[model samples]
Target chain A: MISDITLGQFFPGFSPIHKLDPRTKIILTTLFIIEVFLADTPLLLALMLLTTVIMIGVSRISFAVVLRGIKPIFFIIIFTAFFNIFMTKGQGEPLVHFKIITIYKEGIIRAVFMGLRVIILILGTSILLTYTTSPISLTDGLEILFKPLKKIGIPVHLFSMMMTIALRFIPTLIEETEKIMNAQKSRGADFSQGGLIKRVKALIPILVPLLVSSFKRAEELATAMEARCYRGDKNRTKLVKLTYKPLDFLWFAMAVLLFGGIIALRILPGHISPDSLIYDILFYKV
Target chain B: MKEIIKTKDLCFSYFEYSDNDNVNQAKIDVHALVDINLTVNEGEYLAILGHNGSGKSTLAKLLNLILTPQRGNIFIDGQDITKPDLTEDELFDVRRKVGMVFQNPDNQLVATIVEEDVAFGPENLGLPREEIRRRVNFALNTVGMSEYSGHAPHKLSGGQKQRVAIAGVLAMKPKVIIFDESTAMLDPRGRKEVVDIMEKLNREESITIINITHYMEEAARADRVIVINDGKLIMDGTAKEVFSHVDELHSIGLESPQGRELINELNKAGLNIDTDALNEDECTEAILNKLKAI
Candidate 1:
């Protein structure tokens, strides 16, 4: 069960996007968010979509994988769109103007745009970072970025060690959870056949064992760490240091161009946002 | 006659359940180890014999500094392990000096690959990469697991995994190694393989070995045998001396070797049979001698 649910949701591939350094990918994801929010026109939004599509293409990961990544957040998307449609007030006409219930044209337009932006943001991130970079490489990039903190006595090696350990145990704990669930099921604990509260109560047997085993594992790991003479935070070195290659630079340059172009298109004249265009084309079709 | 490890009047107890905020507090006093005093000499192979629930594991934990003695001091190469000046960093020094191989090879193994796991201890020491690689290779070679360096530990047999675990500890270059029931989970072939490796490491490297085990035959391989029952040391001597008193051992719920058991029965039946066959081959020869006499 834990193995099936991918936590990082990273798709392993050999595409250009996968070859990019995780720090570069992480920075690019942040930049994409900024560009998405700054986009004021439908044309700029279309450019953002184009950039996402290109990223998806270069990643060579299937579009269905990215869609699967967004499955969990679909409810959040709908809820945000619903709130945007009903909450905002605007001048002029209303699409559904009932007693104290006014859904304005502008509100509908903003809702559609906001919903699209959220989806686009999720899509861009899944394709760029999660679907491409391995978690070890991601932590390696983080350790390199945080290496300067070592001078301030921040224990970067230790932090990276903790990250490595956490990543290592993610699959282990997931496997443990599956085993516990199976054990509980064999003992006639009906987790699948009960109401919400009853199901939760039935989970206690599994949870208790899981918690105990995890605590035991943690204790053993601590002992093992100490046995290796791990004295926190001083005179530590890594076997694998993060290195930036030409591919990372190329990917970085592409992201910058895409972001700058999106911003320029947003500021240009006579360009309409996707929401307003959709509402105008749909609502004003009299 | 160099001493690798010495414990002075060691005693330890576990008290749990007082932490619960119940109105009526209860104390579950578990006397895990009591009044244990022993010394392991340099390059000596020693085995501790005990059944389950015995204090052998507790003693192993104490040696590695996992459990602090509630009563006495344990000195590793003349350095007191329980000293206050010895911080956790210093305790690691002690650990490096005295490597430990746990019972469950699965739980103790931290890495996915065999070579990586072997390198774990040396890497944690912050050794140079080349040195780490060299040590990893040497340790794997010592355990006859050099060919398995690339395989996943999970894919290996119980014996192979245990050997990998031994290799991991061996990479630390510890002067002394404590195998705490490591071969208990292995099959007969695997058990013999582990025993042979332990003997080789002891003989070639001159490393002190403290093997905790339940098998009397394995204990017979040791130069000295220590038996514990109900958290106290009941007997400590050479294999011949310790295994001589079959009735005393049986009274303590300890099982002797099948050869020893047969000799005891023959003696009780008024047969003039010797009772000191340590191994099956010796027992076979001894039985043949008794048949010739008859």
Candidate 2:
């Protein structure tokens, strides 16, 4: 059953984070992700972690949720750490120098910081955007944000329109797929009892009908759209306006201030990027 | 009575490859409708009676301008649909006057949320945000779906989905609505809910309703009925005038409604009963009158 998929899941609540406008959340989430990677020093990474903790508190989402968003692609984080620990060669005190593979102190620090960077990025995004904002609002926010692309002949409304239709039909198509599968299974088609190849072969019965039904649905939807006088033009108006209220401005301001604080740290008289900072803290002889 | 929808000598045929949905299947020329000259007055409820492949749906689509007639023109609110120079915006204006509620509820609705789906038509009309909201609210309340405005479409039952679809079309404030067998896919309760809504719209709101269906009982309830068989309009009259010819209806693969059958049978048996009785109470009254006279 594909029903258990909690991807792009929004936890409905009345918390401050949930109350923020979706556009504000999307912009700030983008800023937070950029800051997560730009946070070079261990102290900056610590600050990003602190911001994540505070936002999570405001969001009212549990710690399990923050981890759950990263659970699927967590291997990528581990792989990045491994890559940094093994390949990040620098003249520093060896943390683990077994034979020719000299794992330096700088490598260990960078690897740890890189892992933290990924976890912080994933947590901040999932919490602020996907967890707090509903998918429909999120889509509206994206369409509004990308409205400028229309000037470049990108057909911005068309893309967002497609996204909206896709999001609307996902559950419908899934339900139809399940019905088709059940119909096929009732006819003595064994899906679970087959080997890999045979299982794939058994899926043809379900897939063909599902495809046919989806195409039929697509046609009907097109007719419905046409009947409603959908002009497929830029002059069309929306029901819900993406208005930035006082709460949105407040959230936007906080994100800017946090971003400014990180930039100030980077441009400080003796400050360096995180990669260099890690090198100095680990390998630079005092 | 001003005609809200008029189709003059309308003819339409579906090619095997005309629509992409039927691609890769066996292809044959399907003559859906032929030479259908019908006029629907404003605020009147007209039912198109037919079995499957009987061209009633083809007529419904032509009325809404969803499928243009291949041989004739449809006039909606006095706009000719077959105008050679008709702009796309003008076509939309025609569709605006003649809205349609299709058979499958899941297929007709485009939005995930119920209110958003209801607001779809107004939004497409380029109305202001507040106006769209107002229409959405009003339409949902009319259909008794106000409680489910925030609910997802896929989560709703067949009846609720059909109601939402109706609200979506009703939000456009169309003068006429064509139900293309809208209740065909619903259960008995869902079918009753849709019929009640159709009756309400026709009686209270004074909107023109063209319901296409094979169900004889529903057709009996309409103000007027037109029977289409083999792409030809064979019979057209009020329910009393029409159901009196039960043999002709049965000849075209349609049975008279239960009450119509009882009254027609009694008349055939030489009992002096009115064959115009459409419901159980009326049929019983006719029988009682005949027995009292005896």
Candidate 3:
């Protein structure tokens, strides 16, 4: 049951996107997510979607797998589209009206654009970052990016250790949870046939044991870490240092150019920002 | 022999909270180790054997200064970590000299990647970047896990993960490594993998080994064996000398090796055979010689 959720899963590949330094991939993914938010029209959203498809192509990972990783985004897209369809006040007459509901011509366009923006945002990040980069290197990239936080009195080394340990335990803890749930199910515990509150109440059997075992494992891990001479955030050296190669700079520069292009397209004629819709209704002549 | 580790009348106690009828009176003093005078020589593979709750792990913790003795001083390479005047740096130096590998490989590894986990110890030591790489490579090579350096640690087998944990300690290049039941949770194959690595480290690297275990077979192969019972050292000698006391071992709920048990049965059955054989091969040969004499 837990295996079906593919978030944060990596696809092993030998393509250029997969070969990019994790730091480069991480920074580019952030830029792409921001570009997705800047998208206002169908054309720009289509452009962002095209960039994600190109990244998926470069990675050689199957489109189906990358799409499966962002399955939760479909729900968000639908919910947001409906929200805009109802809440977005239109400029013209309503096409359909009920007792307290009105669907306007402008609302339909706004809903379509908003839904595309969200879907493109999810696709852009999942394909470019999580699908291609392994979790180990992702942690490494985070450690590198977090080094500046050390100067602000934050324990970046400890934070990275925490992240590494957390990632390492995800599978183990999931397996443990599955085992506990199975044990309870075998003992005639009705986890499925219950009301909402009843279902949560039925999980007490599993939760109690899981919490106990987690604490036990946590204590043992702490003792083991101490035995390994883990001095938190002190003078430390890493084996896999984050060194940018020529390829990383090339990819990073290309991503920057693409981001600039996104901003330029956002400012062109016929590209509408949601701000203009509200501006015509407030403090401006329609 | 240079005494690399010496414990002089070491005593340790910690407060343990056990669920009981009297909740307020639950803070009980648990004596994990008491009055333990022990010496571990340089470059020796010594095994400490005991049953559960017999203070085996507590001794391992004290040897590495993870748990300090409340009543005595533990001298690691002639530096007493329990000295009141010692600074934090001095304690850190003592801990650096004694590396440790634990029972659960999953709990001990601090990184997601095999090589990154192995490099964690040296990384903590503040070594140079190039030196860290060299040590990681050498450690992985020594453990026969160089090829698994880039793989995720959880993807490896139990034995492989344990080997990676050993590499983590080896990267630090400590003079001594104490295994506190490191093979207890592994299957037979994983156990064999770790034991072979420990033996190789002891023989090829001249590293002092303190193997705390419950497995009699592991202890029988060691150069020396020490028996701990009720938080006190009961017997310490060569393996042959310690295994000779079969009845005493049985009284403490510890097993003798199969050969030792067979020889003891021969001696008990009114047969005039020496009960000194420590392994199956030796016992078989001794029985053949006895038959030939008959």
Candidate 4:
């Protein structure tokens, strides 16, 4: 029952990228996202895609797993593509000869490009961020990054403390829900066979007990914390201090170069014609 | 002797609601614990004996400051628990010193991974990562759960989960670990597993243990047995002294161990036997010796 949901969700590895500091990973991911946003042309977007593919290769995770991560966003991709293709009005030559629905070269180009960009963005970030770093280390990185927020009286320490607890409890609560479901099922509460309203009514049995247990758990956790002399912001020290290494510097350099290349391409005074052979073959056909 | 915990005129009243939703209207205060005075000597292994609703759990909660006395004072390491001067932090400090392990091992465990759950208390203390690691290892080793450190708590048997829960409390480095019928939910094998860990912790680590249980056999293993009936401290003494008063125990809706009953039957059936046979092995040996004598 407790094993159903995945939390932390990290694939353990000894790879160089996986071994990098979580703060470094977080920074590099942000850098990659900036580069993705700056990517306006096919060439620059291909570079971003190449980096993500290389990341997936280096992490040694199966391609199927990476693709599985994209499954949830498939609908969003389709929705945006459909909306952009049909709704975008362009003054350029109409490509499709249909009644009241004219597909322009510009609209078709805009839709495919927008769809590809969103898909790539989601895939790249998922591989770099959530699928790799453990939640504990992620929180460690966040706490360190937001340490400066303490100066502005933001209580960054408490913020991280809350994050750690929340992350720690997600799996716990999921496990509890599974247990409660099983217990209710044991008592002959059939959750599967019902209409929408009946199904929701059946869920009340699960939800109420889950809520009660979670609160009880929170109370117990608080008591346990108190027993350990835990105060939110006090004399606390971390065992692992996030240290940026030479590899991190190399990553930063690569990111800057990528961003520089994108800007160089975008700012240049040359606009390629809509009939660029590669753009049509790669995106328009789909 | 340093009195680790003391309560005077302690009483607890839980409400019985006719309707679960209407807490305000149909609430009747059902007295859980009555006026009681008890002292826990430092480093003592005390087992509390009572049937359900006999106030054993109420007493355990009161000692840990999880449930403050409604009509009395509770002292932990000599500090009054309900003092106005005691901040929430101080109360936490008191709780840390006195950790509690509840009945359901599943409910008590809050983390998916065993090691992470064990480290929860130390992490809450905001200890250095190294220190928390050290405590987790120490606690796991104390409960003989070091080998299962990486295992999932849910994958564990009922007994193993209870051990994990104990390890979690142990990581807090609490001076007094209270088991509030912690083993009641487990099978016999699981109960023995938890009791063995408790035995080792009390014997070797000098961690005081207060086990509240309905099982009189468990009380047989404690250094002292305290019987609570309807919230009153009816009896307090060594295992033999308490268990010998079988009639008194039976009067309070409790029973001596099953082996005790077997011995009484054997003795009544024209066999010379010891009624003080507190454990199965001892009772078995006594019966075999009597058989040889005949």
Candidate 5:
């Protein structure tokens, strides 16, 4: 049951997005996130949504899979929307009044905008980053991006090495956890039929063994690594080098255009205001 | 033959901390290896046999420089490695010359992808990108894991994962490879697969092999066998010479191969059988010859 997690999931493909350099994808994902928050007007939000949809299409990942990635955050999206619709006071007439609760046109608009922002953020990062780039390349790109931090006494390479080892061992540890859980269950341990506190208490039997075995694995792994001539990142070379290609530059330019468009929309005159006719129609202004 | 590895009066000990809460408790020094003099020639297929806690693994680690000897000296390619003044670069050079494949396949693999893990050693050596790629390819092909190069290691079976670990060590192009009970965790088929690779590497590639195992059948296949017991080297000889001391081995909690045991049993039953047979086929032929004479 624990193996069903989609964390750091990568769908192998020969699409253009996958072909882009991991560093480019990482930077673009950050830029896309910023654009998601900068989108205040309905037109801007629609543009962000369209771009995310286009990216998902280009990645060739099934739309259902992308939606499944958002499933874990479904409750968060709903809670955020509900909280905004109830608590947000707006300079407009009430849409509905029930007892002490009054909902406004502006409150509903803000809730829709916030909900779309969260959804677009998840979909956009998942398509460009996790879905397209493998975990190895992702960590490699992060290491390179954070290489400057090393000058400030930050152990960037060490962090990346730790991340790589952690990723490699996650499945192994998960399988071990399942085995331990089953062994305990065979001994008549009840984990599923317990209250919150009782369930946590039941996990102690599994956690103790898992922790002990992990320490053993760590010691053995250190010995094996030292035997292989690993001496930290000093003078170490990489088999796969990340080089910026023409496609990377093209994506960079596209990102610049998107950020520029968002800033332009924010600073421009009254031609496309947030309370325009499109916003009224989209938000079902009452 | 050139001696690739040599040890002189090597001694190592682990300090076991007592569980007592006394502030002035003395740390007990448990000797793992003591006064071991051994030499390994280039391109030799030697097996080190010992039961658990017999200090065989400590000897392997000493050769690989994973653990320094508390007292004596180790020479790799005729360079004394136990010197206090040995530089880090020199230490790395020695390690590159002597690679090690561990017992647990899961802990040895550092990369998620098979090809990347194979390239780990070469990458640590700071080789050029093209050279690293070449070595990774060659190593994977050597281990017959070329098709699984792109696959995740966790998806592989135990034997396949162990093979990948071997490929990871082979990528460094070491002159000597140490199997520190590498097959102990494997099933019968997995054990055979790893033992086959060891033989292939020793015979075809001329790489020196030092396999540390408790399986007598595996030791019977080696050119030389050394027995360690309680932190001391007890017996060192050819496979036939070592297995002939069946009574002595039994006293130390070790058993001879099945063939030797059967020959001994037949001799005790008032039938003369050649005790020289170390494997089943040879013992079978000897028994058939005695039967035909009757």
Candidate 6:
């Protein structure tokens, strides 16, 4: 049951999106996330959705897999949408009148918009960043991106090294956890047949051994790393260097175009606005 | 042969606190390694055999500079690494020269991918990108893991993971590689695979090998075997010389290889058979020859 998590899962592929440099994918993912927030009108959100769909298609990741990525956060998404629906104040009559709650037209629109925004946010980042780029490359890109922070004495390399090590050990630790759980089960420890507090108490047996083993592993790993001459990014070199290809530049150009379109939709005059006409006709019937 | 690693009366102790809550508890010094003098020549296959907590691992750590000696000096390639004023760069250089493969394959790897972990040591050395690439490829190929380069480390078997760990050390191009009970967690097949690599590295690549293990068969395969008992070097000799003393090995909580044990058993049964055979093949041949003579 603990192994169902698909977070940070990379899908190996030979698509154009996968071929782009990890740094490019990371930057573009950030831009797309910002664009998701900047998208105010239905037309703009539709454009964002179109971009996300195109990306997922290009990466050859099935829609089913992308939907599964959203499954773990499905409850949070529903809570957010419902909270916005009930609590948001609008400039119109109530769409639904309950005894203690009133739902407005704007609130419904806002909730739908927010939900779509979050869905697109998850899909866009997962497709461009996590799905296409391997975890090592992703961390490598992050380390390079945050290199300038080293001047502020932030220990960027240490953090990335920690991240890489954590990623490397996640599977190992999970396997260890499973082994401990099975061992406890064989000793007649019941994990499933308990109340909330009892269940949490039951976990102590598993957690204690897991923690002890983790500390042991950490000490051994430190010695092993020391034996390998690892000294925390002091004059360290990379075997797989991150370099920009022509495809990256092309991706950058496309991102710039998207940014410009978002800006134009936000600041352009009402009559000349491409999204405004659609917004007016869709929401208020000009 | 030129000595690549030499330790002069090296000593190390771990201070165990009596009680964490007590402010004035007396700390007990657990001597992990006590005065020992040893020399590892270039391209030598030296096996350290000991029972658990016998200071063999402590000796391995001291050689790799993971643990600083409390009282003695370690000279690697004619340079003293235990100097009090040794710079960090100098320490790293010495560490790079002395690579170590640890017991657990799961803990040692720093990268998610096999190739990246192999590249880790070279990357730490700050080698050129091309040089790192070349070394990583060469290391993987040398370990026969070239195809599994792109594979995730945790998905690999224990033997494969240990090989990748060796490849990780090999990429650094160290003069000496120490296996600190590296095959302890592996199955017999995995143990054979790692021991074979140690032999190959010592024989073909001319890299000095210091394998710390409790396995008698593994010790028999090494050119020289040193037995550590209770933080002291109890026995150091050629494999044949060491394994022939079956009673001494048994007294120190170690067993001679099956071959030696069988010969001893045959000798006890009133058969005059040579007890010098250190491995099964030699023991079997010696028995056959004795039987034919009879």
Most TM-score-accurate candidate: 5
- The number of the candidate with the highest DockQ is 5
Residues B1-294 of candidate 2 have per-residue lDDT tens digits of 898778888889987654555656657787888888888889999998988889887777777677777898888887787878988788888888889998889888888789998988988899888889999999999899999999999889999999999999999999998898999999999999999999999888899988888778888889999889999999899977888777888888888888768777777788757547886788788788889989
Fnat per model, in the order shown:
0.27, 0.85, 0.76, 0.35, 0.90, 0.97
Compose the digit string of candidate 4's lDDT tens values, residues B1-294.
899988777788888777667646787788888888888988899999988778788788777677777788788889888676778767777878898888877666655578878877777677789888899899899888999988867678889989998998998889899998988899999999999988898989888999888887898989899998887899999988888887788788888878877877777787868557788888788888888978
For candidate 5, the share of real interface contacts preserved is 0.90
lDDT of candidate 3? 0.83
Report the C-alpha lDDT of model 1 over B97-128, residue by residue, as the tens digit.
Answer: 98988776667776656887787788777788
The top-ranked prediction according to lDDT is: 5
What fraction of native interface contacts does model 4 preserve? 0.35
Ranking by TM-score: 5, 6, 2, 3, 4, 1
lDDT of 5 by residue, A144-230 (tens): 999999999999999999999999999999999999999999999999996899999999999999999999999999999998889
Give residue A196's lDDT in candidate 2 (0 to 100).
95
Error of 1 at B86 (Å): 3.8
Give the candidate order by descending lDDT: 5, 6, 2, 3, 1, 4
Label model 6 with its docking quality class: high
* Model 4 chain B weakest 10-residue run by lDDT: B104-113
Q: Looking at candidate 6, what is the lDDT of residue B100?
A: 94
Pairs clashing within candidate 5: none
Model 6: DockQ against the native? 0.85
lDDT of each: 0.81, 0.85, 0.83, 0.80, 0.92, 0.89
Clashes of each: 3, 1, 0, 3, 0, 0
The TM-score values for the models, in the order shown, are 0.82, 0.92, 0.90, 0.86, 0.94, 0.92
Better of 1 and 3 by lDDT: 3
Of 2 and 5, the candidate ahead on DockQ is 5
